[model samples]
Target: MFKNIKSTKTLVKKSLTIFLLAMTAVMFSSVAMSVQSLRGDSALDSKANKAGKHKIDTVEGGIERNFELQPPMIPHTIDKYRISLKGNGCMKCHSEKAYKKEKAPKVGDSHYVTRDGKTLKTISSRRYFCTQCHAPQTKDNPLVDNVYEGI
Candidate 1:
């Protein structure tokens, strides 16, 4: 009976170790895959050289003109935005205070409105998710050419 108990303990320990190792391997592989995807050569970067020397407008242009217009294309990729909430990274340059200092465009007024229709003087907790409305600009040419007359 003692021998059987000892063998059972050994089996449990082995099974636990195997499970732990398998989990660790899966975690590591997942991380590695993510890293590889991020690092893989971007076709866009290579094509950047082929792009015309036309000067494209940036968010700064919209600020200069006031937020009456859609801002220019963002120069950099915003793919890392999914990692955290507070660190949207856009707030680094486009926040209220940052806009004052950098003369960049301040976050829009609509961002201060709550879902319940209350207008907060500052960005409301509900509006903290930047990506819900805002999107990163890309260099790709538009697929359809249409006259979009604004109302």
Candidate 2:
């Protein structure tokens, strides 16, 4: 009967679909088991390397940037300085009013400009954190080979 034939055809189609799905799952699971990262079996949560023990260099002037538009490096150590929401010790010397007396470089003029393009009398709140852009230099060797020449 056509009804019997239709029922058998439907059953066979469903069986073939289930078989194909099972095969695809097996292939994907095998590929997943064999694949690995460059870090090997190390866990995602664990650190890949230890922290460097070298001290930051206190360059007399400043470190020359290898690339243009690089943020100027801090010439001195910042161990004694404190930067917090309430106060920034760096502004004591680097502020517009004190840079001349302190003989320290003035904070960049761009720091006075707000995100809205309006220039403010004081340093913009967005640029208040000095260490966010600038960092002290270290005399330690590079982790990888350096072939870069100054631009």
Candidate 3:
């Protein structure tokens, strides 16, 4: 009638310019296929891409606590132990006057508190760095699935 409303307004402006040029060619082809898959190749290394050297697991005894304030895995063999910044050889048998004459295993009471909870009598220069939260248990197994059901 007015030339069918100017051909239905040029068919809704050519269907909204072909749906905005097919959504700008699918948003620039998904950012050019995410910058061509992040320019391909890149996995560096560090035993994660495994190839050779990675055998250092001989620490006999301790490895149990995986919860309840978990931090007890030294077992033995700290290879030439020396927690640096001067000395510490694991406080020569877990300090507390050398854990009952080096029978070992003392140094608890939360290592004498202090990180604002303040209960120090000793061992708290921010817990005098004992491998920054104990670790050394190796013999590897469970690199992933842990389930962890503890309190």
Candidate 4:
């Protein structure tokens, strides 16, 4: 009877060991299949691969804003347009004078208002640099999963 108890104890110990080992293997396998970075298999410290070059395109209407009060993005390529202190090439089409004839959207009325709340005939100096708030649009896929839902 003592021998029988001893053998049962050994059997239970072996079963428990096997169960623990199986659980450990499952945990490791699940972790190995976890999320990876957009940089493919590159290490976090390594430099990311060069992104594919794509032509800048113009949306028929415009890109929808992701959130309220979001700055509008440039739909067309701005590679040739100059935004220097000398002159603004964008004004040729977006300014009030040219928008009517060029069939382009006019600059926002807010651009003519000063920081002091005074209105001006032309774009205020504070809003003169268009690129500061607007970025050229791209169709590139997001580098990682984004769960951001803007209101």
lDDT winner between 1 and 2, please give it. Answer: 2
lDDT, candidate 2, residue 24? 100
Clashing pairs in 4: none
TM-score: the better of candidates 3 and 4:
4
Clashing pairs in 3: none
Arrange candidates by TM-score, descending: 4, 2, 1, 3
TM-score of 1: 0.42
Residue lDDT tens for model 2, 69-137 = 777889888889899989998899999999999999898888899999999988899988999999997
List per-prediction Cα lDDT, in the order shown. Answer: 0.62, 0.84, 0.72, 0.84
Look at candidate 1 and give me any clashing residue pairs: none
TM-score of each: 0.42, 0.63, 0.23, 0.65
After the best TM-score superposition of candidate 2, give how far the Cα of residue 147 lies from its true spot, in angstroms.
Answer: 2.1
Cα lDDT tens digits, model 4, 1-151, are 9999999999999999999999999988876667554455666698887645766768978777898778888888998889899999888899988999988889889989999999999889988899999888677665546998867
List where candidate 3 sits over 4 angstroms from the true fold.
1-65, 72-77, 82-87, 91-109, 113-118, 124-135, 141-151
Determine which window of 10 residues in candidate 4 has minimal summed lDDT. 31-40
lDDT of 1 at 15: 100
lDDT of 3 by residue, 1-151 (tens): 9999999999999999999999999989876555522213334342243233334555445667767777777776677887777787888888888888978778888788987888877688877887788767545454345786766
Select the stronger candidate by TM-score from 2 and 3.
2
Query: Number of the top candidate by TM-score?
Result: 4
Candidate 4 lDDT at 81 equals: 88
